[model samples]
Target: MSAQETVALVLAQAPVPPQDPGGQGEDFGKSSPLGLVLLIVFAIAVVFLIRSMTKHLKKLPVVFDEEKANAAAPAHVKRAEAEAAKRAEDSEATETPEPEETSSKPSQAKTD
Candidate 1:
């Protein structure tokens, strides 16, 4: 009923058993080699899946044309071709060296 009486009653109760200091069960990580092998396999599969998806994404069409698939080039193929053509044009424009105009004779100054 009173705070002092409640405190005395709680203190009079027997304490619970002290638990083992060594908390870990002996077979913790050593439980299953099969689980580790499965985890490794899963990780490898995920890596392969990610790599395949990235490769597929890299080969994707930048532009779409349904008829192109029936023609000489597919949509993705045509997009790659267009990009190649653009790069070629840019390289050609930038790569060509401009010729310097040169006169064979130096101009002589006429003294009056």
Candidate 2:
């Protein structure tokens, strides 16, 4: 058989799909209320995640190199570092060394 005749026979034998009468299938291609609720929940989650990411990003230093960051430190950062250094110095200066105890008893030599 020729290709054209074979194709024609196959087309003739194909079953036709049933169509909705009077377009009564309104539910077709329509999302359910649950789907709408899920979409809203996902949007809210995305917004919260973005806010959290922004907060975390703000906590990060502008530069990872300490020398470079200090060289180009902004006024606020410089003030914060100064306060931290002062606090450390005060803590170290306020720490007291414990006094060592001396025993009054004399040591005796052991003979084997």
Candidate 3:
């Protein structure tokens, strides 16, 4: 009639679950060959990925700082850079003529 008695009566009539004979079943703690094959495949993929990453990293510049890299360059390389810069400046100067030159060319063409 009471809540405790009703619960006890229901629990007493409930079917009991079967217990295992020992700690483990027949196939417990066993692994299939497919699992081993998959593990090996993943390991090989990781190795290849690491090798590719290392190769890409090796292709990058040793020093990211341009100033330090330039300062560490050889004397001949520095001289070559200076000469190239001078040549570029000279080419720019020659490419850009005074406005007077353009005016004189048009006037000479009109006279001719």
Against the hidden reference, what TM-scores do the models get?
0.37, 0.42, 0.44
Off by over 4 Å in 1: 1-7, 11-14, 18-23, 29-31, 62-112
List candidate 2 stretches off by more than 4 Å. Answer: 1-14, 19-25, 66-112
Clashes of each: 0, 0, 0
Worst 10 residues of 3 by lDDT: 101-110
Q: How accurate is candidate 2 locally (lDDT)?
A: 0.90
> How accurate locally, in lDDT, is each candidate?
0.84, 0.90, 0.88
The residue-level lDDT of candidate 3 at 109 comes to: 46
Candidate 1's residue-wise lDDT over 11-104, tens digit each? 9999885565456566644748888899999999999999999999998777777666558566797788889999999999899677975988
Error of 1 at 6 (Å): 6.5
- Please list the residue runs of candidate 3 whose C-alpha ends up more than 4 Å from where it truly belongs after superposition: 1-3, 9-15, 18-24, 66-112
Minimum summed lDDT over a 10-residue window in model 2 is located at: 15-24
lDDT preference between candidates 2 and 3, better one: 2
lDDT of 1 at 83: 99
Least lDDT summed over 10 consecutive residues: which range in candidate 1? Answer: 20-29
